[model samples]
Target: MTYEDLPTVPRAEELVDKAFSRAARAGRAKSGAEAQRSMLQTAGNILSDNLQNVTTSWPDFDRVDPFYRELADAVVPAHGDCPGGVDGLRTHLSEVMWAGRQAGHIRDEYQSKLRGVDADLARKHRKQAFARLADVTREVSEDLEALGEARDTLKTLPDIRADQPTIVVAGYPNVGKSTFVNRVTNARNEVASYPFTTKQVRVGHVERDHVRYQLIDTPGLLDRPEAERNGIERQAVSALRHLADCILVFVDASAECGYPVEVQLALRDELADRFADIPVLTVCTKADRSRDLDADAYVSVTEEEGVEELLDAAVEAVDYEIELPFEG
Candidate 1:
């Protein structure tokens, strides 16, 4: 699930306001003392319940798949706004929960203080109790705001399935990688005629012999070192490193994609070395305008040629991990 689907966490002021608003709406028709007690109880309940819900709704990083957990670990800690990373978020959230519980305790304590006091004085004490609760709530305003910021940052994360056999397509800019994915998977993932057209990873699914494979189309590669990669590219690299069962590196032989054959080869070599543990299949696109590329496979999307070969190679690369039933 995308982080956007996660529950919303209200700011401290908002929570306090809501709790007080609910308290105001609580019944006050009976004895003033009883009415004051009811309002405090209602306010405490509202505060505590809202805090509890926010804590519970957060994604449990411990229980999630490796991909998401790792992704969270990578991003949350790096968030400049979130002081404690994932643990920090947890700590802040825990503090909010504690504040909620304390608000309830404060209400109960003040209610007891109201026991022998006159109605007007009891009303004064109730306001004092709410003020104390609000103080607690306000103290953690930064934490609450940090949590909200973290949520916004996390929502942009791509939703990728960790259970499936996955293939990642990587190469320099404008190498027909997106088009290749569209043609092979029958998925209408966005395709444009410019470099870095795919700013985020696009996922598609195809079933070969009932064994599903997830195809990932990554943004265009840059001819630079990994250490120098920007945040978006680093995220792509992180996902690819953890999730790729196989990688398909494409090259443009005709130089129509702007980068020359040699530059594209350097990129392919770099990817092959980087993901040395996984199988890397290199395919030369733009075969119709071929200018001699020594690739493991070649495909011309415009002429609709060599696509089957590319698909066949992809299936074979993934099929190695598939355990077929033996006929004894």
Candidate 2:
């Protein structure tokens, strides 16, 4: 699921101000005890509904695709003041939800207290309820701020479609992975920065036989050894594991990418071991410059040579089957 549609989380002060302002208008429309009751109901309902909306606006982390779930966890800490994790984010949401319910309870209690009271007494009950609701809201202000930060971070994630057959390109920097992706896919390929990493992830698409395949080039996460990567980068790589149908390990045989062929091959073997369940193909890039390394396929983006064949190999490795409808 895409995070682009997530609603902006409202701050506590903003929510309180909005609810009370709207409640005043409702009170102006009525008279006496009824007016006070109307004002209380309006304000309470606004706070409860808005706080609940903030909680519900976030996609359930447990039910979300693992790729997005872990990626979000890596980028945003669960609590504004504590460490980051899915459970932490859930806790913040839970607090906000509880606050919403408390607002409703306060409304009901004050409404009950207003019964048989005169205009002034009813106004006093309504004011007390309003103060209580505001306090409840203020208590979860940190949670609200955390959710808002999460929304802002998650919304910026690259729109990678988990449904599509994905080919993850892995190699050292300047190994021609990006060049190959650009050459093979349409002009719609996107280069988006991950909030957790300084590097940018390039996503491109190619369609064949009416089925679309996504090519992803993740720089910092996949270009190095597992032990060399930081915790956040490792988590990011773990997230990619869920999206990869096929992994293309690009090896620059010419060593012009500034790494020895041996190092590149070692990374390939490491990935092969890590993603043993998925198909991992070794590709020798920069074929025009040198074809010294043995690989499953060879491609040279400079001459636009063998690029389509390599893409075809990745798709073939994916071996995605089209599901057909059954007729009884």
Candidate 3:
């Protein structure tokens, strides 16, 4: 909840104000009896209204639904037969406040570490590397446009030519990354009926406009696990770690690995962490239907999707490797 929702008990204010007024007008209570009585009355007032301030001042508990339930349970005992009563909610709120602050601190600490060498790299030659890729991407786009027009004019399709025609279609499995390779490259590869079924690597190549990209369809990635016992995944990670240059990360927004868009974000963070500076692209493969997942990184490849655009993005994605001395 926002700051407005936090509880605000007037404990010191009520006690101080009355004491001040008596001191200003009637002078100090010489016997200290009046002072003791005033203190007791103020304490009673503080106890009576303490619950309202506690509940109101506490941040919104909507995100942590269980916390609110606990607060209600704590309140019911003291307020059993009374109207708008309050019990141990203040004590509970105190606990909640401590935990919340601790969580915030932890979250902020970890998030700072996740940003990577982006800042230092950005300052040095990393920015230049990305800028060079962007330039190449623009150039490739213009070249593709010319090629498309020429193909239409000649009524012929371009074919990919490679020595081995190895295409490593890297992405999270179940995103039809293999299926796209099979369809476009016409590779005789297995198309799984389930997630992570293509537990092996398959490579194929398709050429367009005299450009041949060997599509290597790789096993799915479970970002959380390393020794996941999936050989295909091991091979895929090996490629990501040491072999491949152009990487495509497939996402099934419909099939959220966890209940949040943040989970997918975490997956992205893992990818960026593992493969820094690699040319990676995102493929939204399950666009045939809508899922609640909202991602900033993807080129859609669903039914009636823009295959050309996807291909174009793929071109741009790989241009990073092409402009470099690295060979995929």
C-alpha lDDT values of all predictions: 0.79, 0.82, 0.46
Instruction: Write one digit per residue (lDDT tens) for candidate 2, span 120-198.
Output: 9999989889999999999999988988888887787778888888989877666777677878886344333222222
Flag clash pairs in model 2.
Answer: 77-84
lDDT of 1 by residue, 223-267 (tens): 688778764565567667878989998888888898988888888
CA shift at 32, candidate 1, in angstroms?
Answer: 1.4
Candidate 1 residues lying further than 4 Å off, grouped into runs, are: 1-5, 73-95, 138-142, 152-156, 320-328
| Full-model lDDT, candidate 2 | 0.82
Candidate ranking (lDDT, best to worst): 2, 1, 3
Best by TM-score: 2
- What tens digits encode model 3's per-residue C-alpha lDDT throughout 1-328? 1122222233333323443344334313322333333332332233223322433444444443332232232222332222211233334444333433433343343334323534343233322322332232232232223322322322211122223223346655566777777767666667765777665555666666566676767677666677553544665665455445566666666664222435555666677677777765655656665444554344344464656666666666666332447677
Estimate candidate 1's alpha-carbon lDDT, on a 0 to 1 scale. 0.79
Clash pairs for candidate 1: none
